[model samples]
Target: MSETRPAPLAGLKVIEISAFVAAPLGAMTLAQLGADVIRIDPIGGNIDANRWPISDDGTSIYWASLNKGKRSVTLDLKSEEGQKIATDLIAEAGTLVTNLPARGWLSYENLSQHREDLVMLRLNGSHDGKPAVDYTINAASGFPIITGDDERPVNNAIPAWDVAAGLYISNGIIAAELERRSSGKGQEITLALSDVMLATVGNLGYIAEVQATGKTRGPLGNGLYGAYGQSFATSDGREIMVAVISNKHWRGLGKA
Candidate 1:
């Protein structure tokens, strides 16, 4: 095992009103750093307790992994008493992380009334009002076009976009916390899945440069765009990734 580092959020208090992978991972990250996190679930329960890969007794190991080291409470947020409890909890909480639909539910307006300084993170599927998922998001961001062979485009097999957004949200939350320390005021941060996907594409600037000139990028099967890179299957059925650093290396490999 690696050496343990000091917990950065030793005295912070957070309340998580979220389910699913993105926001829960963010909340768990904070808790791992020694923050006090209370996970508020619906009275009927937010997580689907009957999903796959259960224990011998039928407990959801997936939920347990994401929810380790946190306190949980069941509440009915639609009820008058439940809303009151949430409001009070927000007033006392140093941070709030949630992924629920923001408009009809507890809007920033309603929550700000309770405590203007409460730090909030609202995660969404789209920047506007359109609902989206990982595949659709990857498609919109130009990742899928250059994903597969020329014959067909393929969506990424992993939920890379969602995981990226979760990490970015966690970092943004801590940045907001630092800003709060200096300014004595908290903030509200919004991260959308669509926006995150777009940002991921932006990291590869060559793609944008090509698109700007009325030309589009394409999938270079088993090779780099203008250079040499290969993703190949070995005789043992294992995958190997190799990239050429220079013309010399390319020529040497070609000869070999």
Candidate 2:
């Protein structure tokens, strides 16, 4: 018989008060890694409960997909009793993940007061205090302009910024946990959707070209930017994305 090994975060607990993508996704990732994630939704449910990709019975498949493996609790956040319950949960868990606007009861100052070693990860729309979502951030980040084709600009069907920001938030939480082990204190981590998009585009050098040379990159259809790679249709009309960034890859493609 084989013995079972314990998960890395077997004893860890996470209290998540989040909606939509960033924070929820981050909490889900933590849950997957064996943390006991308790997702707190309002009495009517969070905004994502009825989001798109619903089932035939009107169930939100999208919500179910992201929230799997986590325990859920519904509360009336507006009520004083509900607020107290939430505070008690946070104090007990000592770790919180949320993307809602920082205010009132859920604020880090308020929660950390009760538990000095509380770790809070907060996600925001924009760094400049302006509200922004994944779509708006993608539009302003210069990705749409260089995405589709020369005829028109098209936004990505996938919420790339949301996913990236969520992963970043998960990474931040892990880092904070590591720090807390040594420092014997918790830290507040903040992330903005717009900042994540901007940083990603800048890292990819798309923003650097426009800033350094005033040369804006245009749409290149399915081809990779600054690389010899593109999608090609086969004889049977099946499309395949091919990357020939090096001479070896070019030769390999020719041979195939």
Candidate 3:
């Protein structure tokens, strides 16, 4: 006999109307945790459907990787009928996760009027009502400047802000669900990519140090910040990166 395991979000349902990284990744996280996630894309698919990192056969590996374990539906959000259908689905699911702007038919005020206990999680680029993306946010948050070597600023290979913001949005959804259980009212949660990166920079004490001492942190190539760490080449021509952050670790590395 096989053992049966229950998922944490088995009974939860989420209607995800989003494209690109952050919102889709957040919905995918919820789906992986056993939420019934219904992803509504545009008629011919959203912007990410044909995004890069594709296979030779034109399949978008990037999109597939992020959109796993979710049911998909296509609709023309611009049309009145399509809008009604989306609204119906949203009302039925009682939860929506989207990275689109909070306006038009998808606005919290418009949706909440239909279902009072509707939980809507909106992901945006900036909190100041300005448009932004992962790369822009990364640059604006001062990460790119301190990422690479001392030569010049380099953008990161990974969309760090997008991934982090996605996880944060997922966490927000879970917390909102818990709150709704007791309050019997759904709430709107808004997350911005820029805010997430800024918060991360602040949490790491980078922003505080700059504010207090008026000093800018420079980039350290392959070295850990405030620690004894660097990459070294072995005698056999092999490379290894090591970090000795504590006294015990330093002693252990020395002994080795």
Candidate 4:
């Protein structure tokens, strides 16, 4: 039998101060994988406390799902004592994940004073720090133009950018943790929501395509980009997605 090993993030302590999808989800991901995560909120709860998908008694399943596996505390962050508690927690945890405005007590500069090697990962809406969210970021990603069957631009309902940013946040924290372990130093990591979308569009060659061809790709609804994929409806009123990513797969599809 193979030897057993502890979780990659086991024994890691993290503090998360956030309200919505990206930061909370990132922290939750870490918590699920064995990091000890403590989420700090206002006296009652954060703004996403009553977010959609509520249960009959009025509980936010959306928020709960994103924050599962993480311990939570509510404090009056506006008060000096409350700020002190939060700062002390951050200093002890040594890692902070947040998407809130990082001014005031939550600022990296302020927290780093408590622990010289604190790893603070802050998320911003835009590169210049203007406010933005998943819907707004997705609107600028150029995906909507190729999302539907026509060029009218249909935005997907899914918060793809937010999900991507959440994963990126998790990765950022891990990388920072590793760096801190090696160098005995910690640094501030800033991730812009818009930059996630921009990076995705660039990685997918959409920006280069526009530059090289001077035109946007035509709409291809429910189809792969630069590949063979389609959604098919069966006579039994069911739908299935099919794709051929290789020569063997294409031959198998032709045979079928």
Candidate 5:
């Protein structure tokens, strides 16, 4: 007989007061890893509750997919009683994840008062603290301008910024958890959506390319950037992306 082992985040409890992609997705990832995640929604639901990818019967597949493995609760957060309840939950859990423009009762100042060693993470639209979303952030990040071979900028169908922000949120949460374990104290962690885009574009050399040469890489449809790679329709009518970035790969391609 085989023995069962508990999950890595087995005893970790997370109180999530978030909506949309980054916050919910991060909390959902922790829940999947066996954390006790309690997602608090409004009396009806959050903004993305009825987002796209609906089933034939009109079920919110998008919501289900993002919020999977987490427990849900609907509370009238505007009410004083609801705020008190939520404060108690955060004090008990000692951890929170959120991306909303949270202030007042939901602010770190207020929540930390309840539990001094509370770890709270918040996501903002930009470092300037202005309002923005994935598409808005991506537009100025220079990705859409070089995405496709078109006269007009081509926006990504995939919310790449949101996806990346979600991954960052998850990573930040784990780091904060480790810090709490080591210091016996908690701190606030924050990330701006625009900053995530800037970090990625800068790391990929796109920002440097424009500054160094005063020229930007134009769109090369279906081709790998700065690499010998392209997608072709195979004999089976299925499309395959081929790359020959190295001499060895080129030789291997020729041999085949």
Candidate 6:
């Protein structure tokens, strides 16, 4: 598969200053496609470091899986000297990624100052004044209420909002790079978990419009809605979803 890769980012360097799944995963994808990815770790490691699945050699497989093809360098950005190192790295780097909020990371602003041509991907919980984590984003966007059994609605089993925001951030970085090739200027990309969930729920934006007009949309059971969709139990006792939109197919299925 390596032989087939075109490696669009062969000479580009990316500095990833992020913890946990989302931001790291984005940087890793760029690295796999041939970008030189450098992970910036805090002196004592980030909070999410070594939280699970330790190998015999004490290496965290969870971390390795997400950060496989990247180099790591530790620095204490809180100190003046450490901040200088991070700023220098960013000035040399073509792209930078971070999940930490701008307010929390003082060096982020400084790096931008030093490298005006640096493309940045900043991921955070919320774009608004509020914090935008997985659970809070899900609830506010009505994603939880639309999920799970009717007895009690729940959030998704996975951290989908975070992942989505990261992917969006990655794409934004690439797009910004493309624009820079034409215009010769860098860009800052921002993504929030809540905005990502809201965009996902936008598939049912019409429903939201109706609800706002004094109509309520709730609990669609395991039956067809408006004679088009149905959720049936499979032979293995699992639910299989089928959607029939055309009248011809509906009639052929004996749904008269």
Please, what's the RMSD in Å of model 4? Answer: 1.6
Candidate 2 Cα errors over 4 Å, as ranges: none
Runs of candidate 6 exceeding 4 Å displacement: 1-5, 52-61, 103-109, 203-208, 211-213, 221-256
Candidates by lDDT, descending order: 4, 3, 2, 5, 1, 6
Error of 6 at 41 (Å): 1.2
Candidate 1 Cα errors over 4 Å, as ranges: 1-6, 47-49, 53-57, 246-256
Superposed by TM-score, candidate 6 places the C-alpha of residue 238 at a distance from the truth, in angstroms, of: 5.9
Per-residue alpha-carbon lDDT of candidate 4 for residues 1-256, written as tens digits (9 for 90 to 100): 9999988899999999998898888898898878999999997788889999999999999988998898988999999999999999999999999988999888888999999999999999999999999988887876777788976988888888889999999999999999999999999999999999999889978889889999987789989987899999999999999999999998999999
Cα lDDT tens digits, model 2, 157-240, are 999999999999889988999899899899888899999998998898877788899898788888887678788889998999
lDDT of 3 by residue, 1-256 (tens): 9988989999899999888899899999999999999999998888889898899999999999999999999999999999899999999988999988779899999999888999999987888868798999988877777776786998888999999998998899999999998899999998888889989989999889999999887887788888887899999999999998899998898899
Q: Could you tell which candidate, 2 or 5, scores higher by TM-score? A: 2
Compared with the true structure, all predictions reach lDDT values of: 0.81, 0.89, 0.90, 0.91, 0.88, 0.77
Full-model lDDT, candidate 1:
0.81
**On a 0 to 100 scale, what is the lDDT of residue 238 in model 4?**
100
Model 5 Cα shift for residue 51 (angstroms): 1.2
Lowest summed-lDDT stretch of 10 residues in model 5?
142-151
Residue-by-residue lDDT tens digits, candidate 1, 1-256:
9998868998888888887677888888889888888989898678654455679998888788878999998889988899789778877886888888765446777787788887889898898856777778887777677876785887788878877887877888889889998998988898988888777777867557877887777876677776778898999999998889898997888897
TM-score of each: 0.84, 0.95, 0.95, 0.94, 0.94, 0.80
Pairs clashing within candidate 6: 125-132
Name the candidate, 1 or 5, with the larger TM-score value.
Answer: 5
User: How much is the lDDT of residue 220 in candidate 3?
Assistant: 78
